[model samples]
Target: MGFTDDGDIAAYRRRRSVEFKHGRIAMLATMGFMTPEIIGHWPGYLSPSMGLKFADVPNGLAALNVVPSLGWTQIVIYFGLIEYSGGFEDYRSGTPGDYAWKALTSDDPEDKRRRLNVDLANGRLAMVAIMAILFQNGVAGTTGPEMWIPAL
Candidate 1:
């Protein structure tokens, strides 16, 4: 954004696009991290060839070390692919985060603007919430609803 003094439309669009992407990821991650604490992880192994069992994975960030090396590579490649799919040309000239997906996005201008605002706000909140959740899970050893009720 400092590249330009004002009217930096490209930077603005790119920033919004990034914010939405991070917001969505954070929302999903928070749910994934907390849901297991409440209802437990998947019933069985997620990767049979690697003998990786989601159900056996520990809660919170500690689970990161349990993933196989190939899984981490796959994750990195997947993210890279998604990022490449949204070419830089689109960010510079066209809609920044508009994947033009048929569902979830709105056609109305007002609704689109509102959704963008809320996405940024929620993303910022989720960024902080995730850190707090991680600290609590890793340090206090509490999760989900149990963190609130001492008797639980």
Candidate 2:
């Protein structure tokens, strides 16, 4: 039996497409808010013992410093992977989730399973790396509860 024969490929694609679009929108919105959020707190209010101070660095350098120090590079890397993995093409074609869904529903079940496994593994790795950075910066500790409370 073929892979497409096991299920409705079109329906699966449509459902996956909607999910992908929603996830992309949510991710982009979060990143938009998180960049400034981190910039406001990092190195200024939440600098670790040896962390660079925003005030000590020039404006240009400080802006550059936040990119790597605040885990923004991970966001960059995620988007980069999306683009490289054909997600960008799917988006450009107005089918936001086709790339991944196609891979998951491809004719070769073994290949599909392998791709999904790798994607899952990579996602976990990224999460671990981000958590490690947060811990390294002391953001994971209970010492700064007040710093996390958003001001209205």
Candidate 3:
């Protein structure tokens, strides 16, 4: 939309806003995928408190079966609360991912732009990496998103 039209920087920004949101989500998902493998087992209420030990859990798609219903419910509720509190106005307005943490923000515009570019690049790479991992697991006869597609 922006490429064909001159002086369409706003349109480009609106598209980039969607990219930024996806990038953030992919980054979070990438961390979640790796966290269990890195830590063996979470020390928090997600694992120990649920009577789940490090050995009891499996990595990749198999881990999804190990988690209890309550764990998923708690996660949904927690994130739901955050979403409800913040509302979707930021995303709707094409300015997403601002948690209002001033400490994490930079006073310099150039610095902020640089950091955002880095974040966007990293997130894009993470999205591709995670998708590749999922696809690899799917092809290996593992349980994952591929099961939902009959063609796969």
Candidate 4:
């Protein structure tokens, strides 16, 4: 359901490539993900398709509470790693190339489809992390102290 225009396709290709690369990084980070706090809330900002969702952390936390400690830190680390790894240009540039030649001509439609799938999947995971934080903080407007925060 993405734009088929030349410019749109170009953007999609570039974004897809970056996301494919980022997903690898995320997988590595999550390999030993013990707590929701460590992963940080993503809300799938990088992905184009999926919208945001809550995290799966047992003790729910919210945006305001987690943004400073967990969310911002995770964003910094993710971007930092991406930069150190020399994926900054690919991450920043959002353009597609001869996608047909790359996806269909060389690989099959299924192979090309997996690239988009990764984006969607990564987005979902990020949303879940965000939701976990929001839930812990009672972001739905209920009153509660964040478990990770020192209770007064």
Select the stronger candidate by lDDT from 3 and 4.
Answer: 3
Relative to the true structure, how large is the alpha-carbon lDDT of every model? 0.74, 0.50, 0.67, 0.49
Best by TM-score: 1
Kindly list the per-residue Cα lDDT of model 2 for residues 61-80, writing each as its tens digit.
Answer: 23455544545667688877
Candidate 1 lDDT tens digits, 41-139: 877786899777887678877778888777889999998997788564546665655556535347887876676676668888888888888888888
| Cand. 2 Cα-lDDT | 0.50
What ordering of candidates by lDDT runs from best to worst?
Answer: 1, 3, 2, 4
Best by lDDT: 1
What pairs collide in candidate 2?
Answer: none
Of candidate 2, the 10-residue stretch with the lowest lDDT total is 137-146
| Candidate 3 stretches greater than 4 Å from native | 1-15, 43-51, 87-104, 141-152
Across 35-148, the per-residue lDDT of candidate 4 in tens digits comes to 444555445443233332445223333344433355567888998886798544443353222224453223555665565565557755865654454454465542233434
Off by over 4 Å in 4: 1-7, 18-81, 88-119, 128-132, 135-152
How do the residues 24-116 of candidate 3 rate in per-residue lDDT, one tens digit apiece? 778788777766655656544446677776567666777678888787789899988975885544445533444344453456777766777
Report the error of model 4 at residue 116, Å: 6.8
In order, what is each prediction's RMSD in angstroms? Answer: 2.9, 12.6, 7.3, 12.7
What local lDDT does model 2 show for residue 145? 28
Ranked by TM-score, the better of candidates 3 and 4 is: 3
